[model samples]
Target: MISQLTHLNWFSVLCAFIPYFILGGLWFTVFFGNPYKTSLGKGNETLPNSPIFIAGPAICCLIITITTAMLIYALNVNTLSGALEFAMVAGIGYLVTNTVNIAINPNIPRPIFYSVISGTYHLVGITIVCIIIVAMK
Candidate 1:
């Protein structure tokens, strides 16, 4: 594990992290702002402009990027095909499922709608992350 960490390309991880984080910003705000708000039952009401909203997701994306990097190194995934396969597995299995699970609650008025929006964001984000990591490798 330690050896794999040393072998991991830190630069590639950063490169991957940037786009994933950016995608989340765009996904939640620019692209699906109204839909997202509606899903939360906010319906045009301004959501809290708390720093935690940004900081929390940034932290999560960073952790995800680092973990993906480690897994790519440890699993010896070197090809584009391998990266895509890994992305699909990780994206759908972990990210999409978790997003859906979180959305299926009383807080979200439109749980399925919220899940579709958030889950797809994560799926695409993970795909980008995996592709960047593998290409840079």
Candidate 2:
């Protein structure tokens, strides 16, 4: 693990990671904030500014980025097309399916709506991340 970490192209990883985080910010805020909240049965309440609330996602984002970076490296995705293909496969085969399972649970309201919105965001974000990683490589 340490040796692999030493060999990773940090800049490429950063390039891949930043866009995902930024896209998430815009996705859950400007684009689908109200609808997402409504799907969760939440009102227009001010979000807490606590560190866990603020930094938890950031930490999770970094973890996701690291995991994706490792996969890109491991898969030997040296070209833009390969990166995109891998991203699509990962997004659909893993991200979308898992999200759908959760979103479609009986307890969740407007399951399809939430699933579509969130799943699209993941797909787009991962695509952007893969493009950057490949471009930088």
Off by over 4 Å in 1: none
The TM-score of predicted model 2 comes to 0.85
- Report the C-alpha lDDT of model 2 over 6-48, residue by residue, as the tens digit: 6677988887777788888888879988887777666476555
Model 1 C-alpha lDDT versus the unseen true structure: 0.94
Q: For each candidate, what TM-score against the reference?
A: 0.96, 0.85
| Residues 52-136 of candidate 1: C-alpha lDDT, one tens digit per residue | 9999999999999989888888898999999999999999999999999999988889999999999999999999999999999
Q: Number of the top candidate by lDDT?
A: 1
Each candidate: RMSD to true structure? 1.0, 2.1
**Alpha-carbon lDDT, every model:** 0.94, 0.79
Top-scoring candidate (TM-score): 1
Clashing pairs in 1: none
